[model samples]
Every structure is written in structure tokens, then in C-alpha cells.
Target: MTEYGPRPVDRRLPTEEARDLMTLVRELADREIRPTAAEEEDAGHFPRATFTLLSESGLLSLPYDEEFGGGGQPYEVYLQVLEELAAARLTIGLGVSVHTLACHALAGFGSKEQRTERLPDMLGGGLLGAYCLSEPSSGSDAASLTTRATRDGDTWTLEGTKAWTTHGGVADFYTVLARTGGSGAHGITAFLVPGDAEGLSAAAPERKMGMKGSPTAQLHFDAVRVPDSRRIGEEGQGFAIALSALDSGRLGIAACAVGVAQAALDEALAYTAERQQFGRPIADFQGLRFMLADMATQIEAGRALYLTAARLRDAGLPFSKEAAMAKLFCTDTAMRVTTDAVQLLGGYGYTLDFPAERYMREAKVLQIVEGTNQIQRMVIARHLAGPEKR
Candidate 1:
């Protein structure tokens, strides 16, 4: 019996350590994640224990600095690990991405004192995280967020709601962005808030078409107070921090999309080679063969696109534009390739019996998350054409 998911992906990593990391990730994915992914997803199970296991294995902290309890891996290697986990189960992949996004503000902009005090627990302390930037009225327009944080003496009180938060209710901490100055992007600031802070609560998770195992909900803050020491960066620097985080976060999304597309292609290839059609294998048909070839090609192209952007990021070059392009192209590829995988499977693909339909549904969200593909095009165009005139 051939494995119907997560085929080997030849990678060009810069270090032998990275090669070993990938091997461990694949072994864990096959043993701990893949065999039960469908069942757990169907049950809407969050797999908190699995996240703890990942934390203990150092998988959750691969891309950050080693001084802060991270693995200190390059972006390229980290993204490949994300692709592997995502290929097995998207909830875990996207979960790790969001957790990293939540840590970005403190890791990149927090003071030395802050890092010394709090960095260890966030990286590998078995505590999950959530990023709170998008509001009900502001997603693509993140700077227009209305969540307010009013400073009083040495503390700040946060009020208003944050929407579309992944890991909303379950996270141990939240990296929140709120209006601390005026109305525009310059007025925003970031804060690290504990999950159990007074006056902070999460609404029921959204009933979505896919990714049910990962919770997405609204977080309400009514006069929640935190000490000034918990604030990340300077006042009115939150938008810049949020944008920086999104640039990296988009690459994570791109990697995950390729994983899903790769998984779908693997399933289609296995099924086509076995299922007989009119005394011949379906894989023998020229038309079916072409579709499989196209799917494989698309997955490869998407993987390469994301990897190129990741290398630029690791080299300390400006990668926002390339990240946007990768996010846009890779997600679209996942959507197209997964749809073709369904078609290749014929009647069996439409039902829940096979994973093709699930992959198709999951791929749709990748286009919409980490900024919609439409928003990505706008970012890329602005980088190319420059920002619009007043």
C-alpha cells in the first residue's frame, strides 16, 4: 500500500543541521499528525497536546534567535518545515505561523529588558499565542483599526474588539494592536497582553467552510489594563510592526499553500495509478496524465516562488514585494491544483470518503488569509508603481 500523502520534496538547504530538522519533521508528521488528521479535523479537535509536543521538539521556535530560546534557523529552512507540517495538517502549520506572528513585535522591537524577562516562555514554554490586529470593520485596511488603548499614568487600558483572531480563545497570550494616538496608521501601538487579563474575552468561534480545528473568533477588550512595561516598541509604532510581521507571515501562508497543493497532487497521483477504468488504469489516459503533470508543475513553481522570497528575507534584503507576489501566486496555485485533483478523482472525490474535497476546501482559505490575494496584488502594484498620489 503506497502512502497517499506527503511525498518527499527535494530541498536545497544551506546547512546539514537544516537537513536533519526536515527529517525529524517528516517523521513526526507521519507518526503524530497525518494518520489522524482527517479524524481530528472532522471532530473539530484543537490538538493542544500536539502543539505542546511541537514546542518540546523545538519546532515552534525555529526561525527566531537562539538567545531567546529559539532554534535560530534561517527563514528558508523554517518555511520548509512549515510546508511539511502543513502537508500533513494545515491547522498545525497555520497555527505555528500565527504563533510566530504573535511573537514578532516583542522579538523584533521590544527592549532588551523585555526580551530577558519574557522571551523564553513565548518561544518554547508550552504557551500558545494569538495575533490581534484585524477588527470587524478593518482587515485589508488594518491601519483603520478602532480598538483604543488610553494611557493612564504608568498603565494603559484597552477597549474595543479584535476580529478574525486565530487561536482566539485558546491562546495563552495575545499580541494586540490598538489606537493609542490618533486615527491613521501612525496612531497605533502594540501591547503584549495575557490571555486571562481582566475584561478580555473571546466570542464563539466562527463556523467556517474549512479549518474548523483552528478557532477563529472575536476578542473583546473592555477597559483591560496592562502596565506600560508590557507595551511593545514606542508609542505609535504598532502599524509598522504589524506590517513587518505580515510580510513574514505572508511567506508562511505561501509555504502552507504549497503543502496543501502538494498533498492533493500526491493523493491524485496514487489514485490514478491504481483505480482501473475500462480494464486500464486511469493514469494511462493522456488527458488525465496531462492534468497530473500540470498539478505537479504548479506545486513546484509555487514552492520555488516562496523559497526565493524566503532567501531574500534571510539575506536581509527588502522582501515585502516578493513576499506579496509569493503569497498571491502560491495561494492561487493551491486553489487551482486542489480543484484539479478533485476532478481527476471523479465521483469518489466529491464525497468526504477521500481527502480531495477537504483539500479543495482548505485551499480556498489560503487565498483569503494573511491578507487576501486581492490585497496582495495591491501591495505588489504599489511596490512596482509606487504608492498612489494624493
Candidate 2:
């Protein structure tokens, strides 16, 4: 019989340079992230040095402008690289995604002067960023958020709590969506809040199920003062900015899901082929072989879906619906794939000895965060029902 090899598809996708970078990134993740991820997660600590290396490699700014030290790659490519990174260390993958979301407002809508001023440092090595939009009472329904930002002539004094802030305490800066007028999406405004601002404090990190190295905390904006110049755009644009950022954020989460699924699949395949049962390896069994096939299929499908949406975004088309679809499908696949990976390995998979357990734990969060899968369905359904065919 003819020898079999990896399946052939449109493998020739990303540019040569991007492929080279991906190889380097995968090697870096294998060397640096995979080894330390578990320890950091167990200790509930962030990986500062890893992020510095990511920034230095020009990975963090892959989708940003080249003039500001960014690689300026397509979101399609940028997201896949993120998936590769996440497959090694989810916390780092998410940290990069959230930071990218935190910078979305300035990149997409800010003035040229603003872009030129902040892009370099923000894209520079070792810098971190956060996006603050959620509140204790408002999550999926963000318009009803209670954070108040009162105008004081040319300054704004913000007072309220922003919940579920990623990179909460450690971020160099934050993109804050706060109330500037009345309650509702229209009444809000966005600001770039520096970490050193007076009256701004982050609560102790919240205990999480997975991706523990990615810090999550509440931010208390108690009369935090900011110059009007720091505003991301016009007044009443916070909702718009937040929505735009989230549209991008959804893709980030989708990439993360793909990564989780890929990692789980990799472990399951390795374990199945190496671990012996009865007279031979588990890979010899047809039942388990089908499971491995399913895992690989799911990961491939998820990758294709997210990359399609990312391409739409890079092409400047309306991609909100696609983004939501990708987020919903990929995250759900992650949950299912990782769960199957655990099942394939039986007792051994249930323990911390295998990464399957951690991958399973990490998969759950992707379904809930970045506009829950429920919300994603609503978004998709709305677009489907709309008059325009997009």
C-alpha cells in the first residue's frame, strides 16, 4: 500500500515571511510558554517576561501599522499565530488579544496625532493594556453600565467600578467606557486611562478556573481625573468604540478556542500512540482512532472558520456576524474537543499529569467570555433576519 501523510489542502496560505514567523513562534511557545504555563497558572501569577518576548518579536503588533514598529500583518494571519501561541499558553494568548482590543479604539478611530503618539509605546516590547467596559450590574447589556464620568471643564472625573477587567493591575493603560450623559449606549464615552492615574485602583485578582496567569480583576475609578485630550474620539462614541473593539475581540476569542482544541488534540494523539493497552498502543484501536480523527477535524474546521472571518475584517467588509459565528462555533468546538480528548485518555486524562484537564478547564471560559455564545447567537440571528444580504 502507498504510504500516507498529512492531508493536502490550501496549505500555501500565509506569506513566506509569516510562515517563518509562525515557525519561530511555535518554537518559542514550545521552549518558553509550554514549560512555564502550568506553574504560573497554579501560582496565580502573570508571565511578564513571556509577554516582553512576544512584544519584542513584533508578534503583539502584527496587525498594527509598520510605521509604529508593528509587523502590519493581516488579521487573518495575526489570529492564526495567536492560535498557535494559545495552544502552548492560553493566558499569554488572551493577554495579547485583550491588549489588542484595548488598543482597537485608538487604532481604528483616533486622530493621526493620537495614533502616532501612543502606537510606538503601546506596540513596544513589554507594555500591557486593558479594556474596561463591564460593571457589577452591566455585562451583556453594557449600555446600562453605572460608571459615571463627569465633565470638569477640560477634565473628566470618573467614579464607578469596572468589572472583569483583564490585565487589571498590571496593564500599562486602559481603554475605559464610561457614562458621560445618561444611561444607555448613546450616553457613554471612551477614555485612555493610564495605570498611574490618581484614584484608580484594581482589586485583588479573581480566582479563575483556567488561564489563571491572565489577571482578571475589578477596577475602581474613584474620582479618577483625566484630561479631555485623552478621549479616544468624540463624545457619545464610547459605545461605538466598545462595540468595535468587541467585534475584534470576538475573533481573538475564536482564535483562542482553536488553539485550545489543537492543544488537546495534540496531547490525545501523542498519548494514544505512545501509551500501551493490553498488547499494543491505543492508536491501534479503531474506536479511539475515530476519536482522534474527530478532534483533528474539529480543529481544522474551527481554524478555517475563524480565518474566514478575519479575512473579511482585513478586507474592510462587515464582519460582525461572521465574528460572532466564529466565536460561537470555535469555542463550542473547543469545549467538545477537549472533553473528548479527556475521554480518549480515560483515567490518566482526568489528572493534572496530563494537559487535557487544563485544556478542558480553559475551553469552558471561551464559551462564556467575549460576548457569551448566547449573545453571539443573538447577533448572528439579527444579521440573518436583516433586510440586507451580507
Question: Who wins the TM-score comparison?
Answer: 1
Query: Candidate 1: lDDT of 256?
Result: 94
Evaluate residue 54 in candidate 2 and report its C-alpha lDDT on the 0 to 100 scale. 88
Give all candidate RMSDs, comma-separated: 1.2, 3.6
**What is candidate 2's lDDT per residue for 102-143, written digit by digit as tens?**
888988888889889887888875688999999888999999
TM-score each candidate: 0.98, 0.95
Q: Each prediction's Cα lDDT score?
A: 0.93, 0.87
RMSD of 2: 3.6
Cα lDDT of candidate 2 equals 0.87
lDDT of 1 by residue, 56-80 (tens): 9998899999999989999999999
